[model samples]
Target chain A: MRVRLRRQATLLATVAGLLLAATPVAQAYEPVNIVHTEKVQAGPYPITVGFSTWPLRAIQSLDFTFAPDGGIEGKSGTLTMTPATRSTESRKRPLVRHPRKLEVWGLDIRALEEQGDWTFRFRLDGPEGPGEGALTLTALEPPGPPMALNWSLSTLPLIGLVAFLAIAWRRTRAEVLAG
Target chain B: MDLTAPGAHGVRAAATPRTAARGMPTAMALLAGSVLGLVGLTWDVQWHTDVGPDTFFTLPHLFIYAGSALSGLAALVAVLGATAAARAGRPLDPTVGGASVGVFGRTFTAPVGYLISGVGAAVFLLYGMWDLWWHGVYGFDAVIDSPPHIGLLLSGIVTMVGTIMVFAAAAEHRWGRVGTDVSIALTAANVTITVLGLTDVGGPVDAVHTAMAWLVVILLLTAAGFRPTRGGAVIMAGWLAVIQAVTWWFSPWAAYAYADAVGLPVRDYINGVPVMPALMPMALIAVALLIEPILKAARAHGNRWLPVAAGAVAGALVAALQGIQDSIVYTYPTPGPGTLLPTAVAGALLGALAGHLGWRFGHMLRLVNRTRPEGN
Candidate 1:
């Protein structure tokens, strides 16, 4: 019975050691590198941020993801985003498992107001240690629909005005000449 | 000017005594309704920016509806009154007689302006329905220049133009300078609304286009449509300034407070500060000042080209002055000289066209009022 117990313990220790060895290999696969408008290196981690709506206009949604050099398999953290121009309170959200990506932490922000540089601060506490980092992104003028589309829509009123005036003028001319 | 003279279109004029007593109320109603409509539109824009769209029956919408309803009702009453008097074999009130137009095989008495205004109100109502449906289908518009919005603005412009016509005609009927003053005020208000509605052209980058358009249209209309009166353009510029300043000062705060009250998480900042205030119509004063001398020279020398020349000068001045102001004050990127030069040329051409059109339209209105026929 003692020899059988020793064999089982040895088997469990070998499996645990193998599993531990595979973690770095899995983490080496690198969180999906998203093309981002702004990137920052927070203590031991690289954070990439971008507006989900392209061209980074005002009043748009934001996407932020953090990939620590050591990976996020056993890490916990928080992200705080604040607009530099606004006095509004900074928004704090827990770093959680990204819905779409594995081994990554992310936050999806619904709307950003005003156009300017927004600061993003990240705080992470993990097996390696605790670290902080900040990044700034410049928000642009709210990108509108295509210029052609906007100009065409705006010109409708001018066309209508001109048409109405032409018709009125014709009718009045007819009436005056007849009188 | 004899108030009872037979006007154009075989329409008999109303007796002077009755017109003197009854005209004041109708004129006052038209002015009030049009002005209220302008105010409502301004408020609606504020609501759109601050709170986003809520319901079809918001407070600002009610204001617009009330204004339209009042103007339409007043015009309807005048038409019905004139038709009744005509049937009863009484002299048509000059106030309502010149407005006679045939519709559906019956003679309806309404000033051309009021008729136009009433039609505009009806169309505006229809467009409002379409706007609601559009919002439901495609979602709320992020910008103001939606097709339905453009339709509504065009109708509103027609309504205001009609109001101006009504007052201008009244002024011709010896209603005094007060009538002229009211017309000028309405013109200013119309210009303000037009500028506001065209937000695309009013942006910091596109302000030059707006300035050119404003200078040409306004200078031409004021110079040609109204009788030459010293300071008329100045008064209009003053009115524009006052309306812009007042609305700018109060609208954002009111919008923000309402949003907060409703628990909407709308951001009030643009860049690092509060959203930019409404653009001022200050360049118009320069155009107005230029118009005065041109109008005087045209009247004194009977120069046919003077109106066009005046418009060109006003347009050039507007482009240069406004371009400089926009760059310095708004921090908008300075447009190249190439951009400015073309703007001036386009402004001059447009001004000339507007001058010709305004002159023709103004003459048509005067002729229609002076040739009323007996019995019909």
Candidate 2:
């Protein structure tokens, strides 16, 4: 009876080892994909955070996505985005969109106050468990038009002014000569 | 105070000095209004640079409106007063008679300068409406050279010129040297404002562009100098210096106080550094000094080309001096001959044009004097 119990225990141990080996492979094969992945870490439970727009720039729209190790199908929580520079205050809102094709939580931001590093903090309480994490990014200003364009636009009023002066001069000259 | 005296063309001559002195209050009101407008404009620009756009009814905007309203109202009152005098068989006061024009089946009268200034004020009011609409559609301008802003500046210039004209005519009356001095000072003030407005385009970094802008400014100043007023250059220089000093002293404090009041984060406050006043005025003053002697010589000789030559020389000096000053101030690379050549040429052309305009304005003054009624 003791020998039979030992054989059963060894068999159970072997099956457990096999399941552990396959767990990572299963995670790798999951449909969850993150583009421009800024950060991926476990916060009690696993979470992936990244910007939707690559190479963040000032005066441009910003889009961010957060996904947990488990699919977002049954997730419920809030995301807060704060500019690290404190030039503007943080914006806090709950996640509502669960795009069927993308299968990830998403948030769209229109414009940042100024160019600098900004921090994004996330909190999620879902069926898998509670999760929290933070990510930081640098916002750069986009390249402007050439110096010539700036010069042309700046000096455009001079033309109108000169024309006005010329017309006034002509009228004055005529009146004087006639008199 | 006998007001009945008919001159040529069925127009009445000016009222006696005693009667005309009553118009001094109206003149003072116009002058005060103009100063308010200038201050409001400068403050508005600074506000935009520091705090970005605020509401349409911002304090600076209200100041500007008040100025226009006051100046326009004063001008209208003067016109109405003159018309009433003329209809009642009284001679029009020279201050108002010189500016009268028949319109809308009624004879409207003010100093010619005030008449033109009032029209400019009306135009400015219309443009203000347009500017608000423009901001709504295209968003607030990141730069100052927008169409509405240009229109506003032009109207402001017209108003200022009218003020100068009114003062000039008054000086010829019993106001004497005092009126002339005030006119000269106002001319200087107007020139200073123009230079300030053009700083966006004529920044010290762009040598050629700065030269071009200064060329135009120098021409205008030269034309203003044509007035038969002594110490024209000194008045221009004094006003420019005073304005610069006041701006440098006040701008930084104002900006800081405003930021603190608004609760703007220290990191977000851009107006901590006081704006550097433009040095182009100093260069123009140098030209003005040199031209004074040339103007005297030209008048003594009755030499037609002398003023033109003087203008050209002044323009060239302004361009060259401004180029050097800009290079030093902005730490810009030395401008090549190519840039210098074009700037010099433009300056010369503008100088000649200025000379012609100056000659014409002087001639107009002479014509007015010739046509005036003989003394009682």
Query: TM-score for each prediction?
Result: 0.64, 0.62
Give the Cα RMSD of candidate 2.
23.6
Q: Which lDDT tens digits does candidate 1 get at residues A138-171?
A: 6776554554564465455457557756766776
Backbone clash pairs for candidate 2 read: B3-B91, B99-B112
**Highest DockQ: which candidate?**
1
Docking class of 2: incorrect
| Total backbone clashes of candidate 2, pairs 3 or more residues apart or in separate chains | 2
**Top-lDDT structure, candidate number:** 1
Question: Candidate 2 residues A1-179, lDDT tens each?
Answer: 46754775687469547743443321111122335875555366566665545677654444456667777777777767677767564766675442212456664333443578877767777775877776777777733443345345434444544553565456456555553
| Alpha-carbon shift of residue A108 in model 1 (angstroms) | 15
* TM match of model 2 to true structure: 0.62
Model 1, residue B67: C-alpha shift (Å): 2.0
